[model samples]
Target: MPQNRPRRPKVLCLDDEPAVVEGITRTLRKLYDVTGCTKGTEALAVLEADPGFAVVLSDMRMPEMNGAEFLAKARELAPDATRMLLTGQTDLDAAIAAINEGQIFRFLTKPCPPPTLRGAMAAAVAQHRLVTGERVLLQKTLRGSVEVMMEVLGLVSPTYFGRTTRLRHLAADLATALGHPAVWQIEVAAMLSQLGYVVLAPEIAEKVYYGRILDQRERAEVERAWVQAAEMLAPIPRLEPILWIVRNVRRTAADMAHQPGASPDLVRAARILRVAMDFDELLADGRTSAQLAIDTLRGREGHYDEDVLDALEALRGGGQRSRVAEVPVGALAPGMILVEDLALASGMLLVARGYEVTERLLARISGYPADALATDTVRVVLPREQAEAA
Candidate 1:
């Protein structure tokens, strides 16, 4: 029989007080690999030097930069590491800000019991694992669903909604450049943010996408779209988090515009998506791609992160065009098609035939010339009658 060894968890503790650090180290050293720091600066250096630490527990009121600031920086540096705030103060505003900005996994007050601290650390580690695993699965699932949803929207308004794939890629690039730990949320949000459009009539969706100013009733209807989107996605387990972010996406932007110091990650993600979606609309409105990207960066205060804007500018300057494969109209089929031009969305190609198109299979085939035969490269589905006749 083989003997089992106890698992040792790595922990980084930051506190200005030597006595407190000593006490925590003594209590946790038996089960955890503890690294203690007296200041945020030193802790950051230690974290930079050692990336193996699984959890960071920091005191709230420290000199130079407080725990929230330290945790915010830590999130960028070691996104997989769990973050927690330990504070003696009971300030509600500060607590909310810390959770929102630093994305702290747990909050603990001074004089915490050894058992309580242990429990919190355990929970934080578990959460870190859960979040990472969920993101991987979500990305895989999203790779397919996002295209389907976006194509549906494109069918409603090709000129405006056709750039969904572009907006998603832009949002992801911006989020990564800005060092957002929850970049997955930004990706999912950008992919599905316009889900509310599905509820509205095609004309309404077009009006919203084309920058047409909405009247009072239209504004109300548009606002309600978020709630409707949330309701629509509530049934799915994976979509719940995205729904939360999407519901609050607008509010996050408004908050950032008013309060610059708040939740930079959330604000940055929302801003990127907002600007990217709006830029696509601008392109739809006859503005050139380069000009649209440049104008978007220059026009607004709370529209996008400066680094993201710079990246977009670089993308434009580098002539980074989307490669879409075009299938001849004569060879069109009932499957997927990759448009080889940058005229519309770039990234994933089109799913040529879905439920709606399947129903109209005969109508589509009737329009094709008798001599025209579908090519294998074009990806087509044959109607049962056509297959039987052949």
Candidate 2:
């Protein structure tokens, strides 16, 4: 049996001069799979199409775009890719400027020997591996920790965490409707939005959820919960964006956009969370329908992002058309939306109404005893295609 060789890392070389690109590709072809482009825009299109390029090398003086600008855009497209600059000695200042832009991993002068160029690329590849490896590890660690925390919160306060589920679904839908990138971050932020509620008594959280006015002291405690939640997750790696969304989930989009370090994605995620959470609160307070809840939000002028509200309205309108059905717990499937809460015989809520069934949630349901549910059948809304099939 023959063993397969490890795949070579991909390298993208962009230079206005075709000869220069060819020279670099020929120098690095043995160690890497090289793609050469004669224009910065062409390279950028390639990066957008396939983000797996391990290294991006560009000349400092390109007619289409300077090396600094190209590398900076490349950083956005492939954040984990190591970037390098090849510039003439006369353009050394531009190369340094690119470094200051935080986009260049290394810059080599033109007319450089093949040995030196190859060595720099080898180091660049190694750097890419380090960055991507750390990202994967951090994501797995963060996800596992988040799941455990959510489970603990569910056990401690099922009502509050159940609300989190509804918030997550709404936020995710709003994100998709708005065409926002980083929907996962928005969803995860929504899932963890109620972490501060752990500080309050279950009854207090229940009161807040139902939109009952809180006493001054109770309000103070709620404020502390928000701070406590931020403090608890501050130390985790790669959670800054999620934390930003959580901390500002209630802030107006205009306010959040002006805050330090705010980016379009973060602001959009926070806006989506704010709308979903406030909408959910209205429903919890006995608003007759999603339309009514949204109407109330609109009446509160400037309290929410109008774009997010628009997305919410569009999504809710679509959901209203889903066909309703009653199915046994065993027949519940992903993409089905619950019309009523799933609670145990003892009145312990497992999943809240309006919550969409997910594979993960289904797995959790399977752990319940045979007679755990209060009713063998619960009402749900089937997706359009599923309803048609039935």
Models 1 onward score TM values of 0.55, 0.83
Sequence-dependent TM-score of model 2 = 0.83
lDDT per residue for candidate 1 within 1-390, as digits (tens), equals: 346875677899999999999988988888788999998989999888776677999999988888888999888777778999999989988788788878988999988999999889889878777877876787778766766666556655443344455566667776676666677778878777877776777567768766777788888888888789778777877665456566666664566546533466656666667666666556544445666557765787755556767776766566443322344444444532233222213332223222212223335445545444333243223444444454
Question: Which regions of candidate 1 are displaced past 4 Å?
Answer: 1-42, 49-52, 55-161, 207-227, 234-241, 248-263, 300-307, 320-390
Give candidate 2 regions above 4 Å deviation.
Answer: 1-7, 90-92, 176-181, 215-217, 235-238, 257-264, 285-287, 319-324, 330-337, 344-351, 354-373, 381-389
Compared with the true structure, what per-residue lDDT tens digits does model 2 show for residues 1-390?
A: 347888999999999999998898899999899999999999999999998999999888888888899999998898789999888857656767899874688878888799999999999999999988977787677767786678667766767767877787788878887867577788889888988988887778878878899999989889998999999989987799999989887777778888877998898788778888889888886546889998999999988878888888888887544689999999999999887778999987887676677787789889988697898999998987898888
How does residue 279 of candidate 2 score in lDDT? 90
Q: How many backbone overlaps does candidate 2 show?
A: 0
Give candidate 1's root-mean-square deviation (CA, Å). Answer: 9.8
* Residue 130 displacement (Å), model 2: 1.8
